[model samples]
Target: MTPYPRWTLRTEHTGYTVRLSPDGPWAELDAWGPHGAEHGPSALDWSHRTHFITPADAAPAEYLPYGIRPFTGAELIAAGPDGERGSWWEFDGAQETGTGLRLAFTDGLLGLRTVLCYETVPGTDIVLRWTEFTASRELRLERLDSAAVTVPVTAGARLTYLTGQWSQEFQRTQLHLTRGTFTMGSIQGVPGHAYAPWLAVQDTTGEDAPAYGVALEWSGNWHITAEAEPGGAVRVRAGRVPHEGAVRLAPGERLTTPRLACAFSADGLDGLSRVWHRYERRLSGERLHRPRKVLYNSWEATGFGVEAAGQLELARAAAGIGAELFVVDDGWFTGRADDTGGLGDWHPDPAAFPDGFDRFVADVRALGLDFGLWVEPEAVSPGSRLHTEHPDWVYRVDGRPARLVRHQLLLDLGRTDVQDFVIATLDRLLDTYAIDYLKWDMNRPPTERGRPSAGPADLDAEHVAGYLRVLDHLRAAHPGVTVEGCAGGGGRVEHATIARTDVVWPSDNTAPLDRLAIQHGFLHAHAPHVMSSWVTDAPGVFDPRPRSLAFRFVNAMCGVLGIGADLRAWTPAQRAEAAGWIARYKEVRDVVHLGEARLLGTPADPTCGVQYDADGRTVVAALSTGRLDGAPLVPGRPARLRLRALDPAARYRDTASGTTYSGAHLLHYGLPFAWSADHDADLVVLTRE
Candidate 1:
């Protein structure tokens, strides 16, 4: 439209535009933001007198090879059989497909073709981008990133990403980049707890400014690197299967990178978060409409002491407390008395369930609760029969000793034989019993990741492919079963895993205060329906502050509520209180799960809460985190929280307190809260009247 070779892709609320440089054949991002963003002069125009860098280096390329982007990072890096590592590609053609657009480039010298693909999520402000590489001859690829995203900034950029160790996952971290590059990734087999495959970049100038976000839909090892180029532009490059060395692309073979979801928001990080949540809901498809049932998992309750009678008793108690699903966690399998043994053996332990596994499941189902089981299919105990029978199934260097974590060795999921065995194990279990839910767990990373039989293989990519294949099979073959993903808590929780599973365990540490902080950070990027939080009696691993059971239930209710406490130890009064909370959660879960979410305040504040608005109703789970003895910053000033996504003219009545207020008043003045030592949390529901 502007005399340049340009294309514009529009989603429901945003637009993304790419243009071929008028003087050259390379394509670059021209505009990205709210609709009509492409009308103005290009923000990425690099026409001013630039630094000593090459034109290709300074240009905001959509996807460039190593030779073109010599100084800065390149999205594609490959070597021919003759050991040449650079690619000189010229724009061959461009096409618009039914799903999205594609721009292709070809290097005649090397007989290689590169295609940059773009697709917008129909109902959300997200553009899915990736690249495909095909060579006439074999090429060894060192780095084939999903896409290279360039955000045009005025001066500097601020990066916000999630990072943490195992139990303390999803810790929101921020880094301001004036120059140079900042990188974070996972080298472990899975997308480990070290970092989530997501990044958000904002201009360092304003509080309420447009922000851009990118998330890689990869379950394997990956990296996201952001570089602040010399000309006030920030470029983010993300890819799958990092540090696995070169992947070989045979002649005429095509390699497609993982999809990198790119989004924009003029309403700052919070708005950017909602964009991701909507896209995820779209990714969930029809599954989003189904109710996320309140579940009781018998992990923290019974541990390795699982028995038929004890489980049935727990199921009875769970049903009484309004739980719709009951799950038997680890230690129910044959020879699995503790963490040391009995992995990779799917059969139930006769000692634990003397009658039969089916009888135990039937008894639990008789209590009006769906049945679920936990299994770590990718792990094998050294003493187990499966491991002894096939020692070669585990990952290890030919003559080297295998390292063990949690007393279990990693199975070579990359191998077809191993994948088949895993599929068979799961198929047998599901075929034999009435398993309405499955909690798939992976506890450790691979130690000696070597496949001697397959020369020059990308072991990481193979494993990832196998993992996804298995999940896809489960979805197609067992559509009725609900899958909950866990990897020693919150490990394999990228978009790839999230799309296949019904829910994800955010962390193993279910202590109320610690979990609140974790969930607070998690909600910044993920939707609440997939966040599976549990009410457990285990004390805080990080913070030892004793919170009431009400605090725990309220905190867990913010997501898919699950109870993991030993209900048999509870007094009748305690049980009655839990029943009330569970009943209350069921009534408002629709809004809580499918609504537009707003984080009122952070966990560091004296009072913090999450507000959900949907179906002409609002649900708020507010909590007081600070000490009770403290007075307000302004004495006698009650804590008030503002609500988001509300109709200003409508009148709403609180279901619990029977108080009515105009929506304008609720928005401007916020609802008031009374905090005390015993009553630290409140679940308030309001219906428009």
Candidate 2:
């Protein structure tokens, strides 16, 4: 067997020195202070300590300092100038088996620990898994494991932590450690914040390391994936609660998390692709249908007093506009005319839709579009039938309604009956109507209920389980239907949520100007297909910028395009322009929807630029967001344009001006263009003869 190298650590003034051993499975970590001197050996003690530390303590010491602190049951074990803290802590590596290493570190001041594991299954090429961080004083456990190969790096790597803005030169250098091939990238520290920023580093061949994208949760849990281009990437997700920090640890506190990291060369990129392929295959095998681009809604169009005829008219309009699916946003179901009534009652309002939902679906389908309905599933109006029937489902405190937001109460999804009732209601609706889409909305956050179930653990688990069950049941019964997740719009945009739903309402506020920034932020980690909506707020909703409707269309084209305005009131010209843009979008929908996206200029940069290219064609968009002195001197000034993800050998012709440019010139010099004020323009490059 080829001997796997292990790392040796030496504490120094600069940072910790880590060396790899030619043979063995053990690694050493040494820490030093300002001046070069052996600060101490990284130690862990399961006997005296109350928690489990990875790379377990060598010599059972009465005093364990600066490494992963120990957790005894729900309490943390502390031993410092102070004595005997919590109890029942145990570190067991043998509990789970896989390929990877785990590290636990604590500096009397802060605690940091992580477990790295990799797993390979037969059908799936690689599966990287991990746990998300949650708000808890106790160490809640979750596991992230993946099936992938570990890439070996021959060159050394450096891990640096910077404070303040990322563009800034220096704030405070926390750790500058040298190790074999791998180093931590960005580690940030804020004085009072519980979670500090950190990055794991690995060496690439060139100056620009292949971008390792990161997805971070508000609760401090994060996942990192290596960008493997045309082929997908390898993802490293967190598993356990090894990185949680205690507010005040008098000279001693420990935290730990299960973490996994991998490094593979371009050769492994193919393997990674196969992994994603297998994942998709399994998903398909499970009959999980991919969600279609859906047209959705807001009550702004049909209004709160929409009757059967009004809804049917709107549905027909949507069908005429090439909308594949139509959703009855709100006011379709309920005895009340406005948002004030009928939330929990999953029945159609007889007054508003006198003909019944079955007929509405039939009318929508007859126009050649799929039918969809909206529901807040998680909330109940006080006057609703469901609330009157099962008042216990509403989360309350001290026999009073717990109000987090407006006149709504959270349904206790933690209860089996609640979950069953929701499932049955949705199932019956799908059976009754030819519904192809569901807009699942959660308007308020979880609050008031100290405990929804009998136990705290059960309540917490049920909260997560409830969502999963709802999604699972929906996918199982309505395999052909798509689900759109909207938590007051965009608030619930997370990886876990994305895995379950097809599209996310980027924001309820889809004003064009607001969309530019919001969409930019959303695309940081999410795919464009997930963000949906188009040209909203006619006569301008927020800012009275009577900008070209084409501008709004083009902006919304970046994602799934859907009109939020009342089409019935649109002028002939407005409708014509929308139809043209929609037609153009349909022509190149696949490329833009699934293509690689690159932000050419920084959000703060004067020249805001973005490019999207896939297959053989490319679209370059530039906006002169900042003030430009005057018209260009030579029709167009030399713009420092940087192109991304393009076929260097392909010849191209610009669709706008019928101009021709070589791929080389386009990449090197960029397409020269000028704009005035907030003027934005786009150039489409098509394959040439």
Candidate 3:
């Protein structure tokens, strides 16, 4: 309707609008928010543009090169052979696709063409955006960001993100920005534990305020920077494959950045989280409907002391407790006595499996469970034969010393020969063994990341591409096998990894309370179906508050439940109790995995839990973390938890206690619970009547 050329990308309940700048050749964001936001006043219209700054710097330009946005940050920065930087690009053309639009620009002098892409994810409120560059002549790229998003703000931006260390990952963090730039990312080759590739921004800090978020679909080194300008706008730019210096793009070659997912919710962080979950469901495709197995992993039970007899013993105990899968963890392969040896060697250890590997797998299947194995294909120990045979396959800075984090060096998966070797090893393993599940792990990040053979190449980008290729191969070549993605516990968790892998290990520290807190933050950014939680006997180093077995089972049941405890050591009564819990988990897993998820009070609260609703059924996992002797409950005053997103007009009946209550009463008065020292957790299931 306006004179400017405008484009609107619509989702189920949101809209994003962009318009060609009236004063320039580039495009700028006009509006972005819930449905009908475009019909109202433009939130991003800057009334006062600071003097001395270029128009591109003050405008909400979509994507611009250095010359256009010289003062402010740029999405693309390139140089010619003579070291001349920046580009004077003019609008070339624009094309509309079924999902979204593609806008192209060209710098004839530099012989460069760039296209900014946008695709609204089907059935979701998230918009996937990326950028592509093709050169008629060679260019050195100093920075090639995927996309830059502008958020409307009055005072400043309230940013919420996730960050943590090795055993403690996915810690929800927050920052308030009135001015200056705030940045977070990983430069360690992998999306490290220091920061998750996600960020949520809002104008104000409140539980019910409108919020916007962005997540990068990159597993390699990446950076996300948010700048608050004096013109009352906040621009966020995110990119991948970050390196120490520039990457070269030869003539006729195309360089495409990873997709950056943008989402908006008027109902605050909770709504923003649901938007993310729905997009993840789109990524999962048909796999979202499939049931995640209740498996038993032998990592906590046996560690590196893997053997046929011991594994069979654990398998028997696991199967007796109704486990659907049995995975022999590390040390199943030859030379793997400890962390120092047996990586890159995929063959079964003759010493561990006295009987052939086939016999070992068959024996586990005979116990009525599917076989699984743990593998770290991208890692090689100094004592490994693969490292000795192909020293050049590992990443190193030629003459610099390579540092080992877990007594292992990372393979340069960017190389075709190395990728082929990895593919062949995995193919051979799957073909030879009756493996139904594969737990792919990466123990450490790359040190001195360099490829001497391919000089001046973007090693980080190459590795990410190669890693995705192998995953695609597994998905196509071995369709029936389930893949669980891990990186010493949640280092590689992002859209790219989540889209390919079936489930992901949230953390290695499965001590009940700590895991509950970790999973709390994890579910805020990811869906429960991909969250593979385990019940382990490992003592909590963070919170040593001893919890009962029931607490452990209930905590793990919040996601794709798995048991890593030493079942052989559990007594007859304990095992019987576990069997009961596992059976209960199976009954409600469908709703927990595929239904709408709502996180209750946080783990910091006295009582907190997670609730799921689907198909007229609702499940709630309530846990009490307060001191047992701290507060005495007055008689007849039970703890009540108010549920969310329920049909208030309907009547609900509890399946466990056979009690019926009006939905109005349930919503207002909440579900009641009686907590004791021995009974600190409860799993409640209800059906609408």
Enumerate clash totals for all models, in the order shown: 0, 30, 0
Off by over 4 Å in 3: 628-636
lDDT of 2 by residue, 203-222 (tens): 44432432221223221222
Give the Å error, residue 159, model 1. Answer: 1.1
Cα RMSD for candidates in order: 1.6, 10.9, 1.4
Better of 2 and 3 by lDDT: 3
Query: What's the C-alpha lDDT at position 374 in model 2?
Result: 83
Candidate 1 scores a C-alpha RMSD against the true structure in Å of 1.6
lDDT score at residue 205, model 3, on the 0-100 scale: 51
lDDT of 1 by residue, 1-689 (tens): 36867889998888899988764567899988888988988788777455776788888888888988778888888888899888988888889966599999998888789999999888899999999989898888888999988998887898989888888898888888989999988888877888888899999887557889999999888999999987789999999854467788999999888999999999888888888889889888888888999999998888999999999999999999999999999999998998999998889999889999999999999889999999999999999999999998988888787788999999888899999999999999999999999999999898788876767777888888889889999999998899999998888888999899999998898988889888988888899999999998989888778888999999999999999999999999999999999999999998988999888888888789999989889999998888764455546666788887788999999998899989998899988887777888999999999
User: Which model scores highest in lDDT?
Assistant: 3
Which residue pairs in candidate 1 collide? none
Against the true structure, candidate 2 reaches a TM-score of 0.68
Q: Write the per-residue lDDT of candidate 3 for residues 417-464, one digit (tens) a residue.
A: 989999999999999889999999998888788878666788888899
